[model samples]
Target: MPIPIELSLHRHSRVLEIAYEDGTRFKLPCEYLRVYSPSADVQGHSPDERVLQVGKEQVGIDKIEPIGHYAVCLHFDDEHNTGIYSWEYLYRLGNEYEARWNAYLDELKQAGHVRKTLDA
Candidate 1:
């Protein structure tokens, strides 16, 4: 069964406090979440068509809209708002953030893109 995620927005800190039904809590920066959104813009039509997001150090969640019982829509200040993040998908993202983020950085390095870590 997929775990339920209760994500609370903390505008002051620019972080999303994501809590899982399994007792996991993640304080994810908005920029990190925004850059990795599972939308067609980022994921593309297939894995081989994925596009790397660059220069997202200043991105923030402009709004969070509810989507039925399946997901939440994230509107980014940078104008990215197509993804509907399901609880199951959000849980997976939080669980694999560190590893996946590192992989993203590696890919960026290979492509000569440098990532700027912003303090949230």
Candidate 2:
């Protein structure tokens, strides 16, 4: 697993920066993190049962807590705090960001949902 050496959340930019031991860094947008949350609400119990999240274009993290040297729990402003993102999962998310984000957009379109930014 590519463990993170540094983690920084930029509230103003609504991005989370994670630097790994291998010198790789990822700047993940809050909306992407929220929609792709590892929580059961999003991932479900199985691949076939995964839910398509929508209307989280402006979602942001309110807080973050490190979990026992393995993962981090993200507290979103929308009150989502169940997901515990492991270093491996986070690494995958970052590395496959473009494809995953595109897939999400396609899913939204197919579901006839429109992306909207929440008002500050």
Best by TM-score: 2
Query: Cα lDDT of all candidates, in order?
Result: 0.82, 0.93
lDDT of 2 by residue, 11-106 (tens): 999999999999999999999999999999999999998999877877789999999999999999999999999999999999999999999999
Residue 59, model 2: lDDT of: 79
TM-score of each: 0.88, 0.94
lDDT of 1 by residue, 14-117 (tens): 78888777788878878778867889989989999888888877777879998988789999888899998888778777888899888877988999987776
How far is 62's C-alpha from truth in model 1 (Å)? 1.2
